[model samples]
Target: LLCQILHCLLILLQLVEIVLFIVDSGCSKHMTGNLKLLINFVEKFMGTVKFRNDQIAPILRYGDLVQGAVMIKRVYYVEGLNHNLFSIGQFCDADLEVAFRKSTCFIRDLKGNDLLTGSHGTDLYSITLQDTNCPNLICLMAKATSSQAWLWHRRLSHLNFDTINLLSKNDIVTLHAYFATEGIHHQTSIARTPKQNSVVERH
Candidate 1:
C-alpha cells in the first residue's frame, strides 16, 4: 500500500498541462512539467535544476515534444515546473538556427525552412503548438522540401529561390537606403526579416 501511494505521488509530481511554451535563451535545455505533452517518455534521472527562487526541481523524465512537423527533441520533464521552456542552446545543438527580432522569434532548419515561429511578449517569447482558435500562436510553417520546391518556383514564375532571397534582401536594403536618403533615421530588425507581417496576418 505504501509503495502504491508513493507511485501515485510520483505521477502527480510529474504532470501539469496546457502550458505556455516560452522560447528562452536562458534555459539550458528543453523542459516541461507536463508528461502528457511528451511522446515516447523515458524516465531518466538527469540531475536537478535550480530556479531563480533557488528551488531545486528533480529532472524526472526525458521526452520529445511532437507537435505536427515540429519535434523538439529530448526534453526533460522536471517535477513541479510551471512552464514549458525551449532552449536556444538546445536548438543550436541540433543544428537549428534561432532568431529573435523586435516582434518575432523563429526556429529554422539549416536549409532555411522555418520549423516554428513565436511572438515576442515583453521580454519573453511564447509559441503555440497547434492551429486552433486559441488567441494567437497557431499555424505551423510547413517545410518546403526539395520535391515541392519546384512547384513553388513555378508558382513564382520560375523564379529561383536564390534570386527570391536576393530580391528580399535587396528590397530591405533599398528601403533602408531610401530612408537614409530622406534623412529619416531608422532602426532595423535583426536579419532585417519581414516576418512580423506574416505573424500579424496569421493572428
Candidate 2:
C-alpha cells in the first residue's frame, strides 16, 4: 500500500510539471512559468505588471518550442505566473487557426487540420504541453536518409570527398570505394573556381 501511494504521488508531481496553458485570445505572446523552448531571446519587459493582491510579475524572454511537428516561436517567461498561457495572436501569426465552441477548443494549421485540442478549464480552455528542453527528450534538425553514401556523409562529419575516399580505400572504414567517386569528381570540378577558397573547402 505504501509503494502504491508513493507511485501515485510521483505521477501527480510529473503531471504538475506538464502544465496546462490557457488559450487567451487577448494575450500578445505565449507565457509560461519556467518551461522554455529552444528559440532565440527577443526582449525583456520594460516594467512589471501587478496581478491580484498586488503581486508583481516580471516578464522575460524565453526560448522557442518545437515538438514532433509543431513549432511555437518566441515565448515569454513569466516568473510569477503559476499557470501557462497561449496567445491566439501568436498562433495566427504562425498561420494557425483556433476554433472555440461550447466547452472545447481546437487549434489547427493553415489547412484547417487539427493540431491540438483543449478542454475548458476553470475560466478558459487549456491544453497540456511539454517543453522540448526537458531532459527526457532531445531535439535535432535532421532529414531522412537511406543511401549509404548519404548516411556516411553525416556519420563522417561531412568530410570532403578525397579524404572520405582515402579512408574507404585504406579500409579505415567499411565504406565502398565507389560510394563517393562521382561526388568527389563533381566536388573537384567545383573546387577549381577561385570563389571556392581554402577556408570554405576545409569544412
Give per-model CA RMSD. 22.0, 18.2
Q: Taking the tens digit of each residue's C-alpha lDDT, what string does model 2 give over 1-203?
A: 32232222211011113556789987888877764544666676645655668888877567676655877777777777876789999888888999998888989987888888889867778877665354442222233333443554455365566865675565654344332442322244563543365423322
- Residue-by-residue lDDT tens digits, candidate 1, 1-203: 32232222211111123457899889999998877678788887899999889999899789878766677889999878888899999999999999988999889999999998889887789986742223342222223455765554455465354654564574522444544565645554545534475531111
Candidate 1 residue spans exceeding 4 A from truth? 1-19, 131-203
Which residue pairs in candidate 2 collide? 37-64, 39-64
Error in Å for residue 175 of model 2: 34
**Per-prediction TM-score to the true structure, in the order listed:** 0.55, 0.51
Poorly placed runs, candidate 2 (over 4 Å): 1-17, 35-39, 42-47, 136-203
Best candidate (score: lDDT): 1
In candidate 1, clashing pairs total 0
